[model samples]
Target: ATSVRRGLRSTLRLGNRLAEEWWRQGIAWRAMRRGEVVVFDRHFFADYHAYDIAGTDLPLSRRLHGFLLAHAYPKPDLVIYLDAPPEVLLARKGEGTIEALARRRQDYLSLAAVTTSFEVVDATRTLDEVTSEVIALIRAFEQRHGAMATTS
Candidate 1:
């Protein structure tokens, strides 16, 4: 009975997560339809991959669901990965085990490897430095895409 309850709970959680992803996709599409730039702080595919929820250990149904969601979801125009060493991350964030952070960093890098519009920025620098680098990247992308630069 406990096993059955756990299964039911996991199933429910999966359903809820799917609904959230779908809703987020809808919002992105709507914003793009209006010619608005949609920026996601954290994307669903990367989140799932980092958390290992999309890994091969799950039952076939869950794995298939994750695969479908990853493939069907619209790819972002740019994915910037702010990378810092796990020790630095722990020192700065004061959260997450070093081992887990390392794993997640690797996972993110793996995803970025296959992603076309991806950039890795060193996050160990000062805030101003990091911000400047990111702005430069965005400006370069805009120029490449023929979008007028925005000053703000």
Candidate 2:
């Protein structure tokens, strides 16, 4: 509850800052076009934003429509979906309660629909396997896309 509220507040509040928004989008797009193998820590908006309390329903199509109208369709080039059991996720819980963690996990699954470039990875694997798989996929993407450059 607290996390959801805070995340909403930050997003809505940040939305008011056009400069930040533009800067972020600019950097992200730049990196993308440069062919940099960038990994977004949390590209989970529909997860947090497109939801109602008590975990009822989300009008995801509405958001997709908005993105399309904004010419934001055909979204990211690739998205990696990391899926692990709740127990596995909970094993690494930092501070949030089980309930919050569950909410976040479900949110990711829900948002998975809006993305086309999604790769689902079973979190049941060992850390080494996960890293290796991610690296291989990213390398493949880079190979096909011709390496990415970073300005920073």
Write down the TM-score of every candidate. 0.82, 0.60
Clash tally, candidates in order? 0, 4
Who wins the lDDT comparison? 1
**Tens-digit lDDT string for candidate 1 (1-152):** 99898888887877887889888878877776765666678888777764434477777557856776667755566788899999999998899999999998998888776566789999999999998998888778777875421210
CA lDDT for candidate 1 = 0.76
Highest TM-score scorer: 1
Q: Which stretches of candidate 2 lie over 4 Å from their true place?
A: 1-19, 44-49, 52-74, 140-152
Q: List the residue pairs that clash in candidate 1.
A: none
Which residue pairs collide, candidate 2?
35-148, 36-148, 79-117, 81-119
lDDT (10s digit) by residue, model 2, range 1-152: 99788767766654554345356657787877765556766543333334532234434433443343235412355667678767677787666677877776776776557654467778789899988898887777667766544431
Per-residue error (Å), model 1, residue 101 = 1.1
RMSD of each: 4.3, 7.1
